[model samples]
Target: MSESVIGQVATTATSQARADVIDGFLGTTRRYTTSSAEGLKQAWDECDLIISHLALGATTRLIAGLLVNKKTDPGVVVVDEAGRFVVPLVGGHVGGANELARKVAEGLGATAVLTTATDALGLPGLDTLGWDTSGDLAGVTRAVIDQRPVALVREHPWPLPALPSNVTEPGVERVERRGTHVKVLPPPADPQARILLSDSTAVPDDLPTVVLHPKSLVIGMGCNRGTSVAALRELLDATLGVHGLAKSSIGVLTSVDAKADEEGLIELAAELGVDFVTYPAAELAEYQVPNPSAHAEDAVGTSSVSEASVLAHGAGLIVEKTKTPEATIAIGRTEPRGRLAIVGLGPGAADLLTPRARKVLSESAVVIGYRPYVAQIRSILRPGTEIVSTGMGTEDMRTALAIEKAREGRNVAIVCG
Candidate 1:
């Protein structure tokens, strides 16, 4: 469970001590004192997870609802006073509630009951949609080995358990994270319910009892086959540098399906706790550039690296395509704030100022461009506003001037030729 969710649980326990349903709320804070703001923030995040774990009070319930909306990964599960039943009100798997349920049950001398189908029917499961912080790895491993069903946490109000009870499972369901497609298929629940995931999406699939919620960014990738871990690290550094993106911004890294089991790729995914996707060769080849990577060309199932890169971009998994190995290390997408609009005005009419253009001009802190262009919007300018203009300026000149003002934290509106 998330620290926030845990704190809510703790708060609930504290407030509901008289209810006797919750054991006394217990926790330790990193804070030496809550009187300080930083200390308070630590206390706040920690208490969130603790309270979420216990689900002990009203405040816990409230916070659980909020975190669900926010998509905090350490999942939430609320249970009855006896701990016999578990209801994953928020993040079910990624949040650690599925695993936490077992721990909580043991702590309470009860069963950490899991309600997801794979668990009920005894099949391999993985919490594909979870916080993926170090803690989730162990639980996911257990589900894989134990043949227990996994519940992916994506949306807040989890759908009811899917597939009718006592249905048959599709033949041979496997729980492998490093697969080409991590999608879920409702292959008719047999006496053994079979739920397999391939093709992961940002939102959860229409499976009963689970949903997927992913972060917003994608990490584009390419690497040498025997790329040493050191090499991978350097790649990550370079990629992050170019994009100006934080590791936290990336949601997943995708490549040709054959690369799924690549040692370095797997290690990288494990290290980052993010998904590593491998797509079909044909699918990957679709985006192949005029030429392709040496390795990608001969890749099994005939996929192209360029396709993978392009697909990642289109899927919004990656903000942009990466061709060079260094591109993998890009910091992130450019968060550019300034923009220029080139208009060919027949009359340069003041009455025709577009709503959007007018809005930009209106909000500009500094309007720097050609003196004539600046003069055209003179009527719209606020009195005493700074409209720095270089007389007799060309479009390029105006663009450069506008960029200068923008770099200095001034909003510049450039109307070019």
Candidate 2:
């Protein structure tokens, strides 16, 4: 959860109680001030989201002066004095105001006032999918909402919610048969509207075409004990550039356990902002690779370090081992990790629902629950999210189905009342 601030018009007793309720559910830092204008302006500069107990008109007026574009602005949600309605005033999708509004409503037993067309029409927002997206997002999202012909182009078959009939998956055969190795797919021919899902950096840069990068790449490395960080970084940059890979797609940096404390490997992983993983020498030796070094086995007790470590972590090699004077680099594409979250809908009232539970429901790609329970939290779920509901006495069936969906790399949530 990100940091947030709560702004109030005054330090009155009523406002103090309301701020306490907001903080209890939000579970973040909270502040109360008699000065609404100063508090809001300072929150605009310091926080990711703001819950304003002031009047909607007043909050809007104050926000109008501090507004940057949607991408940079913080999410603002206005709670009425009575706490009857939670309204997302600005930055609905980009700043996460709509989702915040839903969570707040659940805590306050209020209604979330959503005005975004995509939410109203039950269509997924392009920017809200949690992927690195580029180009004409607004146009492509509108096409999805209007049921226009939008081509879905993918280099790999990523698990996503069911799209509208108007959105067609182009080159289905190619996408279905795509090999483990990463390759750039050609753009749709004369596409009027397009949404691309791929790990590769190369994609068409035309208007109304949005590119979504999947976190699919893992870099396996091996380095000498005293190797310089500069040398390792240079090799990494050159290798990614030559292969046309996106840095955003790289998810992990891995090596043999012998290099776990190696300064160069640790520093490089920190610079790349990816997790560093190390496998035991015996584990690394178990994996077969194209290049196995007898010298490495004599020195580090493993026949291979760079390529084998990636294979040990259940990834297929996309780029073979490339070496420099002090470091060796190899890249692989790993299957997406499956996630399963078991959530309980607290008591019966919406206000009883926990914030963490609400957040899991919002982020899930698939939600499974009883038919009645599913309906309870349906309003908070993102558009286009898949739902599987069953009758009573179907516990085994629901659990089995949730596991199957998760095994396919889908974020799944099971709800229990």
Measured over all alpha carbons after superposition, the RMSD of each candidate to the real structure, in angstroms, is 25.8, 7.1
Model 2 agreement with the true structure over 335-385: per-residue lDDT tens digits: 766689999998856557887887777668778888888888877776657
TM-score of each candidate structure, all chains considered together:
0.31, 0.74
Overall lDDT per candidate, in order of appearance: 0.46, 0.79
Clashes of 2: 0
lDDT per residue (tens digit) for residues 157-209 in model 1: 11111221222223423221211223444543222112322122222234322
* Candidate 1 structure lDDT: 0.46
Highest TM-score model number: 2
